[model samples]
Target: MWRVFLCIGLLLAIWLRWRCKNRRLLEMARKIPGPPTIPLFGNALKFMCQPEEFIKVIKDLMIEYGGVFKLWIGPDLNVVVSNPDDIKLLLTNNKTSIKGPQYKYMADVLGGGILSGSGTLWRKHRKIATPNYGRRAIESYTDVFNQEVDLLLDVFNSLPKGRETDIYKYIVQSTSYTVCQTLMGLSKEETMELPHLQYLIDLSPKLYDIVFDRMTKWYLQIDPIFWLTESYTQQKIFKEKLSELSAAVIKHRYKALANSGDKLHLMNSEEDSSKNTQLSVIDRFILSDELDSKELIDETFTVFTSSQEASAKIASFFLMMMAFHPVCQEKLYSEIINVTGKDDKPVTDDDLKRMPYLEMAFKEVLRLFPIGGMLQRTINEDISISSYTIPAGSALVIPIYHIQRDPNLWNDPESFDPERFSLENTKKRPTYCYIPFSLGNMDCLGRYFGAKLVKTIVVRVLRKFKLNSLHNFKNLRTIIAISTTSLDGFHVILDSREKY
Candidate 1:
């Protein structure tokens, strides 16, 4: 009887300790304003029921709760902020450099690439990958960009004039081809034949949607529960196929390097001044020996996935903008004509620099529709922002979508105006106010490459065709997958400028 009494006493003590800990957490959460949460489940049910309305719900919360607010996602605390000051604090501070839980889903597809890795691994891989985006490297890729753009123009020329069509299809295909050639040295024909590339093309969207669904629904976040679901089974198969494909590519490249011997070294050798036989980015990765096969595969997949998606979205946005605002299109055409001297002439590196109006228009499109609508970080230490205390381990969400469209930041913020990005007006905004490629040390390494690629394609296309839209801009909707994209498609009518 005495032993039984002792056991009961210990059980009661453990229960009290757990209760005290939870009480402290609850007290901390109550300090910040947010939507009313229920017992046990918190806001999980609401989020799960309307995962597609996530961004809209966030925007609505921002209006009600001000710049900083707390949300209880199950037992975890998520502190969301849209103020530029808070964003600067979260992104620039080294303490918050670690990725949030949402990125865990990406690990299945991306492995431990820089996008998903943290600490020493991220640092080491970033050091090795930085050179691929250097000015000289990107400049060498311009030839490939021009060649791909020419192919895209041929496809455009084939389309019947003045008939509405979804331009996103052609843009994604062309950008995918450009990325494969310049980054992996794969031609369009070869890319189509690769079973792994085909698998990724078919399954990536569904996989992203599943990951996002898991992120919003708290109960589905548990590994055991998620693994039992149909989505997990599908994801497992997709990842296996993707890994096999990546492995094959790595082996093929390794063999090619071995066969070429010293020739491979000379191709990337800085001392060798011949531009005619410059190597592709993959050649540099293979020759450097800084990354092992798995690491190489991860980096390549990261670059491939990120660059292809972002470039396609940016190009599609530019096409949509050109269609809606014909006046801007006319001005852009005049500038292109002035620099190139003829519509038929191919755009050169020097010509890309002379088109300032085109740059402004592109900037405007990014501001309104950034590929990444929100950037996330997991707090590693307690921090204060906007006078609110955010505890360690809480998820920090920086809503770039809301901040960029904030009425307080810009006059008539929703209006499509390219002049808003002019040097004088740009200087007036805060540091973190206009981050399409993100900001801080973790900013997109391929920003310059992506910008150049999109501009090259846009310049080439605009020189040949006039973009016009059949649909209303106000009625258009967007869905955020890995990137923000048109909910429907970017339907536009392309007419040859010669006809105009």
Candidate 2:
């Protein structure tokens, strides 16, 4: 009886090995390059063990295996692309796909907003939304940006000269106000609610890891039993808080619009509409008949969460980098003073054109500490790159950070030199080498608005004060979410030039 059982088990094992080998043979026949993958687990362990270093590992793998390489996470195979030419090919190809499980996890947080929505829904939202970011609309939002910057400058001026404080908190406050005002037309009380909202936003990532890490973790498997039953309470609370804030803004805006007769506070009238077509997030929600209240809330939440987070990180990075590099900061500050004449005046688009050094500084910071470090797309159809034939449904990750720091791509890539972005030098580099805003149709929808807002704030802050970091603090640790965030807050000292 024992001998017969052993024989049956051996046959089953042989069949499994045959199936495994056959699958590998098929994958190889496609001629894709990749590292040796272990069964039931792939590159997932790499992400789990070293979250911060994973981007570097993926980049090195791409360098070794070629621009197009395949990596597996359990049964799933991801194709990574580092070469600009291939990235351009993938993104420009109409047949290329983007929807994948990784994005779905983002959707779990972002919901079915323009940021997370795909297909016709995403297209329509993009179409309607593009007009809102027109020149006139962005111009209208300049007041909000300037207002936030003024508040930030005032706060910095009030700080004790020698005392160290975290610049990140101030950056967050300034960014949060700008985003909330421009989007919701939020009142003081409503705007004050943002710190709490930010807290919720900050917590969501930790909760996301606990919830979604199941798929990546070997012991956890795909079962939601642990996360659902025990680990996800905080996530639920944060989601509820986000929903509440969005719902309140929607209700308030709806009431405000209904009350006003001639002056549409949030909505654009015919006359004003021609001048400033920029609609807030709430305005978009109100205009969207196809979207339900729940959907509106979800979309607004995504906007609030994404915009505030990215803007804050960018602001913090700029301040910290400038503080550490005084000469560059002074050069940029001189450019700003030249343009604005040091009267705390609002920056016009024409003025922005003259501040090329400031632009370079912004670009440099973005290159080093990009908010969205990776851009991803899935192959919708079979595509050949070099010697490899890639199959459909495979994910392609473009690590922006790696591309930014590639030694082959840039001379002294690690250094914080802003001159690399001068028009002459910039023209020498590949277009894809400097894409913090990404490229193609699916790139960040609010890139222009974000750029303008960040530039305005940087100019305002630098013109008003000299920034310095806390003593002995050489490094700023960052957390990766939809954006890279300072883990400890960007600590710095401020010296107000205006006061003297």
Question: Any idea what lDDT model 1 has?
Answer: 0.77
Kindly report which residue pairs in candidate 1 clash with one another. Answer: none
Writing each residue's lDDT as its tens digit, candidate 1 over 1-500 gives 99999998887787567557767556766788888887556677767554347767877888889888888776677888878887888788887888787787777667767766667777777755666676777777887888888889999999987799988778877887788877666656666666677567656667777867777778778889988999989988977777676666666566667777775667557764234234555666676676777778777777677787688879988988888888988898899888886556556677888889988998898888887877678887888877787878678877777688888787788878999988998898886778887777888878888889999888888888889998867777866665666777789899988886
Residues 15-82 of candidate 2: C-alpha lDDT, one tens digit per residue: 57755765844465347777876655666677665445555676678678866777787656677777
- Model 2, residue 37: what's the lDDT? 68
TM-score of 2: 0.87
Residue runs of model 2 more than 4 Å from their true location after superposition: 1-30, 193-198, 201-231, 260-278, 470-479, 498-500
Cα deviation in Å at residue 212, candidate 1? 1.9
- Lowest-sum lDDT 10-residue window in model 1: 272-281
TM-score of each: 0.89, 0.87
